[model samples]
Target: MKQQVRELFPTPLWVLDIPPSDAAPFNAKLRDEIEKIISPRPNVPSGSNWQTPHDLHTRPAFADFTKLVEISARSVAQFLNVERYPMMITGCWANINPPSAYHPTHNHPNNYLSGVYYVAVPEAGPDLIFQDPRPSLIMPWTGKLSPLTANASAEQAVPGRMIIFPSWLRHHVPSNEGTSERISISFNLMFRNFAETAASPRWKATAGQE
Candidate 1:
C-alpha cells in the first residue's frame, strides 16, 4: 500500500445524548444479559487484556441499539454531506473496568469511520484522548503556531454522548479512576472499497467530513 496526503481535510466530532426512553430499556436488557453470562470478571488479572462479547449486539435487543446508531450515523453523514450510509457497522463491543493503563494509544484498523458511545463514564480515569491526526509536527505553515496543548486534548465524555471521526484518527482512553467502572460501546464503519475512487492518502472530501 502507498501513503497519500493532501490539504483541506475535514474532521468532524459529534456528541449525542442517549434518549432515556430508548436507552433505559436497552440498559435493563443488557444488565439482565450480563448476569446470565455466568462469567466472573474480578478474576481477570489486573492490567490484562479481556473483553466481553456480551456487550456486542449479538443479543436480540442489540438490533434496537444498532438501529439507533444507524439512524444517528446517517443523520451525521447527511449533516457532513458524506455519502448517505456509505459506511457500514462491521463490529461493535463493550469493554469492562479495564485496569490501570487499560487502553493504549492507537488508531482504528482497516475501517472508514469509527465511534464510541458512552454508557457509563467514571468520574476519573480513562478520559477519551484525541490526538493530532497529522504526522508531521512542523508548524507555522498556516502562519500560526500552537502551544503545548496543541498536540492533543482530553475529551469529556457524558452519557448519551457519541464521538465519531475518520477511522484512521488516533485516540485512546487512560485507565479508569473512580470506584465505579467505566463502560462504552465502540463501533467500526466501512464504506465500499474506495480504492477505485481515492487517489491520495487524504480522505476523499464527502458529506459529514467536517
Candidate 2:
C-alpha cells in the first residue's frame, strides 16, 4: 500500500543570507549610520525596545539601504508573480533592543510584505518567532513537535540575515537574554497605487449576456 500527505495553504518565509565577507563591512556601516540617527538613544520603559523614526527610506544617509530594500521587495514580488505592479516601502525604522527588552506580538497592517534585517546580535543569538494565524488550532500533542504540530515557528537572528514574510503574519521577539543588545531594521512594502491598480473588482458584469 502507498500513502501520502498533502500540505495545503503553506505560509512562505524567505531568508536572505549575505556572505560573511561582504556582510561584515556592510553591517558595520549600517550600525554606524543607525547610531548617528539615534545618538543618545531615547530611554524607553522597561520591557520595551527603542525604535528610530519611521522614515529612514527618505534619509540621504540610508539611500543604499533603501535601494537594497527595493531590490529585495522586487524579488519577493517576482516570486509571487506580481512584479509588474510596483511596490513601495511604507515604513522603515531601526529597532534597538537592549538586554531584557522585548517586543510584544504584532502584525503589520495594510501592507503586502514585511521584513527585518539584523544588524547586530548578541553571541547567544535570540529568535524571531512567527505565530500561527489559524485560530482553530486547538489540538493536543505528545511527541516531538513538527511543523504541522507547532503553533509558533522561530527564525534565529544572525547579522546580515533578512527574513521576509506576509505583512499580516503575527510575530514577536522574545526578551534579549544575551548580555549584548540586539539591533535590527524593520520595514514594510505595499503595492504602489494599490486602490487604483489591484483593488478594483476582479469580476466585471457581462452586459446583455447571461
Candidate 3:
C-alpha cells in the first residue's frame, strides 16, 4: 500500500545571486561606504558584532543599494500577492562581525519582511541559521538531516548573495571562526501606511434577505 504526504504551511526564503563581474565592483563600493560609517567602530562584548545605524537607506551614499532593495522587495510582494500596498524599508544597517563574533537569535517585529546582503565573507564563510518557528514539534531524532527532520536550516554566507524571509522568522548568525572579519548588511521592510491600509479587516459581511 502507498500513501501520500501532504506538506502544509511552508515558509518562504528568497535568494538572489548577482553576477560576479558586477558584484565585485559593487561590493567594493559598498564596503568602502560601510567602513566610512563605522570607522573607529564602537567597542562591544567579546562575542558581539558591530552594527551601523539603522538609517542607511536614508543616506545618499546608499541610495543605489536602497533602490535595489526596493526592486527586490516588489518582486517578493508580487509573489505573495500583496502588491497593492507599497512596501518601505524601515531599517537598514551593516554588521561587522569580527573573529568569534556572532548574533543572537531574534526576529524583526512590526515589519513584514527582513533580509541580508553579504558584502564581504572570509575564506571560511559563516552560516546564517533560521530556526523552526513551531514550538510544539515532536520530531524524533534521525541519523541524518533532511528538510522534514531538521529543526533549523543553515544558509552559507557568500558575497553578492542576498537572502530575504519573513520578518518574524527567528534567525541568528554563527560566530565568525575565520581569520578575518565578516561584513554584511541587514534590513527590514514593512507595508507603507500599514495602519490606514493593510490592517483593516479582510472579510465582507453579507446581509440576510429581508
Q: Number of clashing pairs, model 2? A: 0
Question: What's model 1's lDDT at 15?
Answer: 72
Instruction: State in Å the error of residue 168, model 3.
Output: 0.7
Give the Cα error of residue 34 in candidate 3, in Å. Answer: 0.7
Residue 164 in candidate 1, Cα distance off native in Å: 1.2
> What is the per-residue lDDT of model 3 for residues 25-63, given as tens digits with 9 covering 90 to 100?
999999999989988778887888988999999999999
lDDT of 2 by residue, 34-137 (tens): 99988886777867798999999999888988888888888888899999889999999999999889999999999999999999999877799999988867
- Which clashing pairs does model 1 show? 4-201, 16-160, 18-160, 80-207, 80-208, 81-207, 81-208, 82-207
In terms of lDDT, model 2 sits at: 0.91
lDDT of each: 0.69, 0.91, 0.92
Q: What would you estimate as the lDDT of candidate 3? A: 0.92
Query: For residues 1-210, could you state the per-residue lDDT of candidate 1 as single tens digits?
Result: 999876466566777777777766666665455445525665767764445663465566568778877877787778878664376687877766654536778888988778887766666756788888767675544454343326676778665667877788788777776667676778887766456545346657888776
Score candidate 1 by TM-score against the native.
Answer: 0.73
Show where candidate 1 strays beyond 4 Å.
1-7, 19-28, 34-38, 99-101, 138-149, 192-210
